[model samples]
Target: MAGGGIGGALGGLIGLACAVLPGPAPIAPVSSVDTSLWSAATLERGRQIAAAGDCAVCHTAPGGQTNAGGFALETPFGTVYSTNLTPDRETGIGTWSYEAFQRAMRKGIARDGSHLYPAFPYTAFAKMSESDMMALYAYLMSQPAVRNSPPRTKLPFPMNQRPLVAGWNWLFHDERAFVPDETRSAQWNRGKYLVDGAGHCGACHTPRNAIGAEKGGFAYLTGGSAEGWDAPSLVGSRAAPVPWTEDTLFDYLRTGFSAEHGVAAGPMGPVVAGLSTLPESDVRAISHYIASLSPRVDPAVSADAAAAHAVRASAAQTLDDEGGRRIFESACAVCHAESGGVGHFGVRPLMGLNTSVALATPDNLLHVLQHGIDRPATAELGYMPGFKDVFDDRQLAELASYIRARYAPGQPAWRDLESASARLRAHAH
Candidate 1:
C-alpha cells in the first residue's frame, strides 16, 4: 500500500454511453422522475468535492467549455471521451433525478439504464458515502447544460461490446460501503477509506489478472501492469532519496514534491495538481489513509525498521555489482548523488524511493528508464527529458534488474531487456 501517499484516483467520468444511439441497450436505466431530495447545502458541498476530485480536468476538453463531454482519454483500447453530465434534457443529464445520478456514480449505470464502463470509476466512487454522493449529484446539476452530443465511441472489437462488461464488473466491483475499523486510529482508518474509496488508488496501483480483475492476494498494490503506463508500487517503497515519511508525503500532496522524490509525473501529475488544491485536512486524511494500507516489509532490504535504514543505506556504498549500486551509478547516481542533481529537472536519488524497490517487477523502472519521466509540464512546471535515447535496452534491463534486486530485496530478477524491448514493440499499434 502507498501508506500515506495517493495513487491519484480519478477525475472526469469519461467513457462510452451507447444505449440511446439508434436504440438503447436493455440494461439502460430509465430516469427516475423525482426531485424531493435536492438540497441546497448538499449541492454546494458537491461542487466543492467535485473540484477536489478535479472533475472538469478530464470531462471538459481544451477551449472554453463546461461538460461538453468530449475529452478523449487515450487508453490502450484506443481513446475514450468524457461523458455529458450537464442538465441538458437531450445530450446531458437534465432529465436525471437525484437517485438516478447517485446510481450512476455508485453503480456505473446510466440514468437512462445503460451499464457504464469501469472507465467511469463507479467501482471506486461506490465507496463514497451516501451524503458525499448526494453532494456530487447536486454539483453536477448546478453545472451549465451543454446540448452538444459527443461522437459515438469506437472501442477495439470485442471490448467495444457491453455484455463483456458485466463479467468485468462481477470480477472487480465491490458494492459495499466503507466501514471504518474502530481498533485502528481514526486517522489511519480515514486513510484507509480514502485509499480504498475516494482515493481509489488501488484501481491503478494494484495489478490485475488476465481477466483484468485486481489480482486478489499479494499483488493488490504491490504494483502491477497498467495499460498505458506501468503502475508503480506503493508497498514499503523508499523511493524518495529521503525516507517516505508522513511529513514528506504531506509536502508532495500539497506541493507535488519532496526534497527526495520527483514531482508527480505521468498519469499521477494531473492527480497531484488536483490534490495540491484540496483542503489540508483532506490531504492529511488522504496521507493517513495511504499509511493504513496492508503492512509489509521488504525482506531483501535488510532495514525493516526505519531507524535501521541508515545502516542499510551505508552498506549500499559497498554494492559491488549489486542491482542497487549498478543502477544508481548508471542512470540514477548522476542526479541522486548528494549534490549530483537537485529536483527531477535535475536529479532525485534512488537511495530510499518506495517507488524504486517496492514492486515485484521492473515495469515502473523500465518505464522510467525507457521513457525517462520528469515532473510533467504545468504552466510553471519544468520539463523532464525522455531517456529512451540515452539508455539502450540492454542497459535499461540491467539497471532495472539491479535496482529491483537491491531495493526490493527478496524478489528475484525477472526482466530481460530483450524481452522488455519485444513487449514494447508488441504494444505498438
Candidate 2:
C-alpha cells in the first residue's frame, strides 16, 4: 500500500510538470523577405530603434560582420552566443516571418518554439510598441545577410533543458506593455519608455537575485555588474561625488564625456557609442528621465564649488602613502593630475572627479587601470594605455588603494586589493 501511494504521488508530480513544459508550435520558415512592403520611414525608424537597443554591439563579434552574430555573453549559467539578426536563409533570421519575430521579441520564444534565454533582453523588448517592433523587423530583414551560425549555447545538467525556462518566465517575466503616466510630460514619458524598453538600462544597472532575475522596487538601477565592470547606480544612491543633473547626463549620454563626472568605460562604452547616433532630442529625453530619478544636490552648493571641494579633499591625502604616491606620479599623473594640461586624448580627466574613484568598490578603477580604454567613447576623446604589463599585483593594489584614499576620502577603504587585482588579472587572461 505504501509503495502504491508513493508511485501515485510521483505520477501526479510528473503530470503537472508535463502540462507546463509544452511550448508553442514552431512557425514555418519563409523563402525570402519582401523589402518593398516596408516604407522608407519605417526602415529609418527601425534603424533608430536598433541604435537605441545597441543590437549590433551584442550581435557582432570583434572583427566580424555586423549583425552576423558570434559575440559570446558570459553569464552565471554559462556562455551564450548572440544569434544572427541579418536576413540570411540558413544561419540568420531571413526565413523568419514577422509573426515569428514578434513572438521572439515579446515572448522569448524562437521561431522553432524553443524558449530563448532571458539574456536576450526580451523581457524589456516586450514593453516596446507593436509599430516599433515591426519597424525593427523590417530594418533587420533589409540588412546584408551573412551565412554564419553562432555556436549553440550549452549549459551543464538540468540547465540544458530549455523547457525549464518556462518556469523562470512564470516566476519573473512581466510582459505588460508600457503605459505612460499622464502626470508626466511627453518628453519624460518617451525617455522612460526608451530607458525601460529598448535601452534596457536596468539589465546592467539593477541588482539581481540568486536566480539571475533583476530585483525591482527599491533595488531598480541601484547598481549591478556587466562584463566584470561595475555599472554604477543611477538612482539617489549614485556613487559619483557630484549629483548628475539633466544637462550633465545629456552631455554624458550624447558625447560620452561629462565635465563633472567621467568618460564612459567598460560595457557602457558600447552603449554610449550607440547613443551617439541618436537625435539630440532623444538623448535629452533619456537624460531627463534618468535625472528625475536621482536626488538633487543642495541648492546652496554650486557644481563648481562642489568640484573644488572634492579636488581639495583628494589633494589633502596625497602624502598619506609614499609608495602609492610614487606610482601615481610616475605612471598616472601625466593625464590625471590637475596641472598635467591636456592629455594625449585632448582632454585631461581629473581623478578627483572620476566616477571610478568614487564608486563603492574599486572594481571600475581596477578594470580601467588594467585594461585601459582601447576604444574611447569617441575617437577624439583619446585612448588610455593599460598598465597590466607594467604593474605587478602588489603595485596594482597599492596604486588602487592610493587612488581610492586620495579621491574618495569619505567612503570606506577598499580591502583585499592584492587578491582582487590578482583575480581580475587571471580573469582577463
Candidate 3:
C-alpha cells in the first residue's frame, strides 16, 4: 500500500509537469507576404510606431545592417542577442505569417512555439492596439530582406528551461490591449496609450521584482537603471533641482536638450533620436502626459537669486578642494564657467541647473566624464570630449565631487567616488 501511494504521487507530479510543458502550436510559415497589399498610410503609421517603440535601437547591432539584428543586450541572467527583424527567408522573419508575429508580440511566443525572454519588452507590446500591431507587421514585412541570424540566447541552469517562462507569464504578463480612460481628454488618452504601449518607458524607468517583472502600482516609473546610467523618475521624485514643466519636457524630448535641464547622453541619446521622428503633436501629448504626473510646486526664488546662490556656493567650496577646483578650471571651465558665458560651441548650460549634478548619485556625471557626448542630439549642440584618456580614477572622482559640491550645494556629498569611477572605467572597456 505504501509503495502504491508513493508511485501515485510521483506520477501526479510528472503529469503536472507535462501539462505545463506543452506550449501553443507552431503557426504555419508563409511563402511570401504581398507588400503591395498594404496602403501607403498604413506603412507610414507603421514607421511612426517603430520609431516610438525604438525597435531599431535594439534590433540593429553596432556597424551592422539595419534590422538585421546581432545586438547583444546584457541582462541580469545572461547576454541575449536581438534577432533579425528583416524579412529574409532563411535567417530572418520572412517566412512568418501575421498570426505568428501577432502571437510573438502579444504572448512572447515565437513562430516555432518557443517562449521569448522578457528582455524583448513584449509585456508593453501586448498593450498595443490591434491596428497598430497590424501596421507594424506590414512595415517590417516591407523592409529590405537581409539574411543574418543572430546568436541565440542561452541562460544558465534553471533559467535555461523554456517551459518555465509559462509560469513567468502567468505571474507577470497581462496580455491585454490598451483601454482608453473615458474620463481623460482624447490627447491624454492618446499619450497614455503611447507611453504605456509602444514607448515602454516603464521598461527602463520602473524598478523590477526579484524575478525580473516590473514593479507596478506605487513603484511605477519611480526610477530604474539602463546600460549603467540612471533612468531618473518621471514623477515628482525626480532629481532635477527645477521642476519639469510640459514646455521643458517637450523641448528635452523634441531636441534632446533643455536649458534648464541637461543634454541627453548615454542610452537616452538613442531614445531622443527615436523621438525626433515623431510628429510635433504626438511629442507634445507625451510630454503633457508625463508632466501631469509631476505637478510643479513653486520654488519661491527668482532665477537670478538661484544663480547668485549657486555662484556663492561654488566659490566657497573652491577653497576646500583646491585640486578639484583647479581641474575644473583647466578642463571644464571653458564652457561651464559663468564668467566665460559660453564655450566655443556657442551653448552655455549653467552647472547648477544641470540634472546630472543635482542627482543623488554621481553615476550619470561620471559616465558623461568617461564617455562624453560623441553624438549630440542635433548638429547645432556642442560636442563634449571624454576625459577617459586624460583623467585617472582619482582625478575623475575629484572632479565629480567638486562639481557636485559647487552645483548642488544642498545635497549630501557622494561617497565611494574612486570605486564608482573604477567601476565605470572597467565597464567602458
> What are the RMSDs of all candidates, in order?
8.5, 4.8, 5.5
Residue-wise lDDT of candidate 3 within 145-260, one digit each (tens)? 99898888887745676666776787688999999989988888888888889999999989887667899998888888787788888888547776777777888888888776
**Residue range 34-140, candidate 2, lDDT tens digits:** 99999999999999999999999899988899999999988876798999888999899999999999999888999998889888999899889999999999999
**CA lDDT for candidate 1:** 0.59
User: What is residue 380's positional error in candidate 2, in angstroms?
Assistant: 2.2
TM-score of each: 0.68, 0.93, 0.91
Best by lDDT: 2
Q: Rate the local accuracy (lDDT) of all candidates.
A: 0.59, 0.83, 0.82
After aligning candidate 1 to the native by TM-score, how far in Å is the CA of 416 from where it should be?
Answer: 3.3
**Runs in model 2 with CA error above 4 Å?**
1-17, 298-302, 313-318
Model 3 is weakest, by summed lDDT over 10 consecutive residues, at: 297-306
lDDT of 1 by residue, 334-404 (tens): 56554434455533434444454454545555555565555452434555455566656766666666655
lDDT of 2: 0.83
TM-score for candidate 1: 0.68
